[model samples]
Target: MSNIIANQLDLFGAEEQSELFDEDAPTVYYHGDPDRVHARLHRLIAEARGAETLPWDQDSTRLYRKIVPQMVLWLPEEEAAQLRFEFEAELERMKAA
Candidate 1:
């Protein structure tokens, strides 16, 4: 794995990204816990809110790419729909700035 993937796995765990994968897509094993997924999601939400007050350059694509996948993975089936709606809304907010 590349450094980015390794770093992401270290930070968010393998399972968080695995949850976002389609079972039918391919057979790749990821070792991440759901609890870790949940915690990371909450942290990202807090960070995004804080980023609002920071300078524009401080707001970069790297931050979005890192956090978005965790948010998607943290959302469960029942809550997934609502979470996606909120995610898109936040993404739009990011794009506007």
Candidate 2:
């Protein structure tokens, strides 16, 4: 598991660049127990607002990757798509730059 996390961190790839978001959006509803996912999402959102890199490996990198996709299930479909698209686009831009 630790080895997997290290690999994920290596591929997380956004570490060297920061992407800026023009709007502040509340995290869509997440129906889960109070845990790291909730906190991490909030942190991610805040980072997005500040144009910072959103790190992976919360609890574990694999777990962090898993939680992000699951979170979309609780959001309105359009909002979920928009966020996903924007984030991916930024990551792509970062990778390119």
Predictions in order: lDDT: 0.59, 0.55
In model 2, how large is the Cα lDDT of residue 61?
Answer: 43
Give the clashing pairs for model 2: none
Residues 1-97, candidate 2, lDDT per residue (tens digit)? Answer: 9999977985745654434332464556637643454455556654544553434433644464455667755666776676556555654454465
Q: Which stretches of candidate 2 lie over 4 Å from their true place?
A: 1-66
Give candidate 2's TM-score: 0.39
Candidate 2 differs from the real structure by a C-alpha RMSD in angstroms, to one decimal, of: 21.1
Q: lDDT by residue for model 1 over 1-97, one digit each (tens)?
A: 6988778766856566776656777676774566776666556555655654332354555675556565566457666455555555665576677
What TM-score does each of the candidates earn?
Answer: 0.43, 0.39
What overall lDDT, based on C-alpha atoms, would model 1 receive against the true structure?
0.59
